[model samples]
Target: MVIILIRTVKYNLSKLRDLYLHTTCLATLANMAPHVHRLSAYASQRLVSLFYMLSRKYNKLTEQMDDKVGKGGSVEHDSLAKDMSAELHIYADFLRIVLEILNAILTYALPRNPEVVYAIMHRQEVFQPFKNHPRFSELIENIYMVLDFFNSRMDAQTQNGEWSVEKVLQFIISNCRSWRGEGMKMFNQLHFSYEQESHPEEFFTPYIWRLTLSHCGLSFDHNAVNLFTVDLPAEQLDNAGEEHDEPRQNGR
Candidate 1:
């Protein structure tokens, strides 16, 4: 789980943008997650506001792209293409985040997990708008693959008589963190940056292709706050510090 950020002498805008998008996407999903049961109404309101803002920005950028291309002259089409591409990536990332949230809710939040199996059929309807988008297809596919991988693992564990509520929750939380790690590495193909020692706490171990889950909760030590921090009661924390939690390796 040691992610060495590869900083470059020349900063690439796309790398920074991807990291920023991942940050926003994690914040958005964490706020929206039902199991987390974020008790504050403000968090829900903030989620709505953030999504609306992103949607508006996507629309505006698309409109601008159309305007630039519609003039029918070479007004630097590359600039327009880059802008459109960035918007598409962000939107696609949004789509992935929402889908992952839904999966987590249905898989772990529901009392009767079997009852929610049919809901998986509606995924296509939800993602129809992203069909032909450059980034959407691949991102969606990857998310679903993660979904199926967890599902398959759960089934296997169930068959082997190792299934438990705690284990299932552990599987979900571990994979979720690993996904965030993968998101941080999604962009920055053009440039890389390692963590600087200017601040001891400000460091980036960006890549966690798999998560090592302990009983106590997620143990991420990154500058970007993680969503897996659960608020346990004082009694529970004092008595059992991950004593019941088993280490789980949920693959990326």
Candidate 2:
């Protein structure tokens, strides 16, 4: 279910965090999900791909917005320009939220889920480009901390030796005991909260509105107390409405 939701909403950045939280809930339920680690591995990789893709789009949009502003495209002077300018900021925030989700997984789950550590270890190269990214650099720092920890451990293990997927996996699982202490001390010291949104309505309103409009059909009645409708016979609808309007006796 988590994989299905992640893939279904892969392009929808606004929904990814909820899916991550859903995965976390599943992981917390003991014995219910045996393959969640694999899901985490896949999710981490997919999110890495998404981060880079969105970063490129963000860079292009930033350049375009800068050009527009340079040409006297003032928000106060043009309502459309203002909307477009707001879009750039929104897109940047979306990108930041993506990093937040990824970092949250790494911070909260990497130690418990060996597969996530394994995935991050192998994908270290993909993260190099973001080290100096103007918009994402600070957010990516926490991720780099994790990556560096794994890289240092891998180097220590492989020095004057060899490397293999089995060996790496074994090392990660074997060292799980240390992750909560010295191995992940940096992670423990850092703090980030998804609940710290200053303007949550900005995020929640659009998400709820989009989900409702998309799933509950497009026919919304502004005057109706109930906003949505269904295809029902007029007789049945009247009866249903009467039943709904009727007052109920206590406990009856």
The 0-to-1 C-alpha lDDT of every candidate, in the order given, reads 0.44, 0.61
Candidate 1 Cα outliers beyond 4 Å, as residue runs: 1-35, 73-77, 110-252
Tens-place lDDT per residue, model 2, 13-128, is: 44553545533332233122222344466665655666566666667777777887899888688887776677677667656656665665655566567776676677667667
Residue 120, model 1: Cα distance from true site in angstroms: 18
Q: What are the models' TM-scores?
A: 0.33, 0.54
lDDT of 2: 0.61
Q: Per-residue error at 243 for model 2, in Å?
A: 43
Query: 40-127 in candidate 1: lDDT tens per residue?
Result: 3333233333434444556666777677678773544577577576776666565455444444544344333322222332132444
Superposition error at 213 for model 1 (Å): 38
How many clashes (backbone N, Cα, C below 3 Å) per candidate?
A: 8, 0
Residue 198 shift from truth in candidate 1, angstroms: 13
Q: Native-vs-model 1 lDDT? A: 0.44
